[model samples]
Target: MTTKTEKVEASTKIRPRIGRWEVDDHNEVALLGTRCAACGEVAFPEHQICVNCGSESTEVVRIKGPATLRNYTIVHQLPPGYERPWVVGYGEFDGQLSVLAPIVAASRDELHEGLSLSLCVGVTKVDDDGEEMYSYQFTPTKA
Candidate 1:
């Protein structure tokens, strides 16, 4: 089966929304996080200050996959430069951090809280310049 990163690499003009993620040599996408040396808090998007302990010293770390979906809602309306009728939800990873991300599913009925989900690299939208904005989204795990 084709992986998410392989789909991303197939795109002609794929660009990440932020610099916090990248596709590795194996075509697996990984997210960069900041782990505080003082409190061992891991913060996504690699923040300078630790959200848990407010520590200024932190190092970049890779976040693993297989997060659990806590909750979600179908968005009928979309923001500027985005598509319509998408799912957004919060995913809890490692029991320490809960992150809000786009929930990608075959249908809205397939989404629910406490569902097992995993990170997938996908195109959120195509900009006016025709660049595909690659970002992370949570998808229901296959049984």
Candidate 2:
């Protein structure tokens, strides 16, 4: 039998499901993206080559938030391994960067176009190894 401390330790071992994101001690999430040196375009998940200019020159940059919700969909038909419904949306930041991420909301009525969202990290699922997998998600910013 596992002790209580062991369970806590295991729960704290979170692994990011995607690359280019970091979580602080407070659980605040910061997404890392790449900026094209040639075209000055920014992209998430950090690309090696610039998609806009076709240039290999790129630099890693942090994505600053307060993303404005553009659109969203509530998915009821889940894929294999998913247990419940979830919302996903596109949020535009800085009037240039648009990121598609899962949205965390208490109710469907709380979501709408132009809602301000902030980046956060949470456990999306557990892996076969019993490790918690975390992904970047957007939550409604507290007014």
Best by lDDT: 2
lDDT of 2 by residue, 1-143 (tens): 21122344455555443555766666566788889999999988788899788899999987867899999998888755444788889989978788988898647888999999998766665677765655778999988
Which residue segments of model 1 deviate by more than 4 Å? 1-19
Off by over 4 Å in 2: 1-17, 25-27, 128-130
Q: Give lDDT for model 1.
A: 0.76
Cα lDDT tens digits, model 1, 46-118, are: 8889988998999998776778888888888875667778788888987968777888764767777788887
Candidate 1 TM-score to native: 0.78
Tell me the TM-score of each prediction against the true structure.
0.78, 0.80
